[model samples]
Target: MELRWNPILETWVMVSAQRQRRPFMPKESCPFCPGSGKVPDQYDVYLYPNDFPHLMKDPPEPSIQDDDLLRVERAFGSCDVVLYSPDHTASITQLSREHLARLFELWRDHYRAMRERADVKYVLIFENKGDIIGVTIPHPHGQIYSYPYIPARPAKELDSARRYWESHGGACLFCAVLQKELAFEKRLIWTNEHFVAFLPSYADYPNEAHIYPRRHCGSLLDMSKAEAEDFMDGLQRQVRIYDSLFGFELPFMMGFHQEPVDGAEYPYFHFHVEFYPLHRSRDKIKYNAGSETSGGAFTNPSSPEENAEELRKINAEL
Candidate 1:
């Protein structure tokens, strides 16, 4: 795979033709199952190299020519799969508090380790749940991708946050959003001492939620032990609420938003987790068609207030 620069969009596009051959929903033994021979038995949280990785630590030379407009580079990065539980059918919502705390610690450790690499510029921690989210494996796991450069979305967020900081006298943009949400309490789902989960007023998807730390922190490494516990508490509660909403497992994409490891200070950037659930109702799924895919616009079917009220009514027993 090669990283081709798109001059028009100012982003790097990963061209990995080999990924099409990766395994889909296999009917035989699961690769993530304990003692399946692919993975070891008796492990609380497991981290292993991805069987099909998109990037590498030392990648091949660029395949194409480099010019003023078209530039190509090797995809130098690392990808790791994090198994959340040993059980084959376990879900994040079902994991114990202690287990989830351990998982968070693993996440922090991996992030710090990846950031330590001189070539690594950014680390992304995210999970895609359910078949609708195009997850081939049924195991409860997440993936970490350490990139040589910052991805487009996060770069855009950082730029915005930087501009906000400059204009607002070094105030964090996310912390401001969290404070505003707390004052309104209309879109809030749950809040503890350290963190708060709320359906943002500008949510792009139905029932979309953003969890933010009350204090400003650039990355997971900055979170204290107490803050980590509260963060896990908020995350677990949010997942449970999603499952309880439609009386089934909800398909969603959850990702952590944090500072890049490019060795730059980002006091204006606050760490958070964003959840985008695809389901609009019990049997309906929201598809990102024309506007969302081509026009770069999101057309949310429901209002944030209505969605928050629906989620607020469901008190998921944790």
Candidate 2:
């Protein structure tokens, strides 16, 4: 695998051809299953190295050279799979509150440990659920990738926040957005003491939601114990609402947006979670075609207020 820089877009493209051989929808025994000899028999939460990781700690020299237009470098990073439960059929929403809290704690621990490394610059915690979302494994799990450099999306967010702070006399960009959402209230799905889940006015995908902390924090490590518990509660409730909306497990990609681990304080950056559900409706799946992929713009079919209203009506008691 190698990282090729696209100067025009100012982003890194990872070319990992070997990942094509990874197992897809296996019919045999699950590798993540405990007692299957692939993993330990009994465990509440487990972390293991990805068998086919895109990046490595010590990658080989880049296959190509860096020119005036194109820059190439070795892909240096780490990827780990986090098992949420021992059950093969369980989902994140299905886990008990205590178990879910444990998972968040594990994520926090891994994030801190990875950021301690000299080469690590960013740590991304994310989960891709459902086969339609292209998850090769069906087990209840998430993944963490510690990169040697900050990824493009987060970098863009940081840049935006920094500019916002500079122009607005040091005000946090995300906090400002959250405040606006709260004032409007039409896009709010639900809220608790510590966090709020709402469909953003600038949502890219239908039914996409963003969860923001009530307090301004740079990352999960900054969260207090009480805030952590309330964070878990808010997350679980959001997932429950999604499942209830569709009458089944929702196919979605969820990720945490946090400050970089480059040892610099980013007071402007705010920690949050974003959920992008694949389905636009019960039987329909949203696809990113020409305009979205090539044009670098998103076309949301449904209005945020409408989607929020639909989600708000669901009973998120779980």
Report the number of the highest-lDDT candidate. 2
Compared with the true structure, the alpha-carbon lDDT of candidate 2 equals 0.90
Worst 10 residues of 2 by lDDT: 309-318
Tens digits of lDDT, candidate 1, 146-180: 99999999999999999999999988788888889
lDDT of 2 by residue, 106-188 (tens): 99999999878887899999999888978888888989988888998999999999999999999999999999999999999
- Relative to the true structure, how large is the alpha-carbon lDDT of every model? 0.89, 0.90
Top-TM-score structure, candidate number:
1
Alpha-carbon deviation at 32 in model 2, angstroms: 0.5
Report backbone clashes per prediction.
0, 0
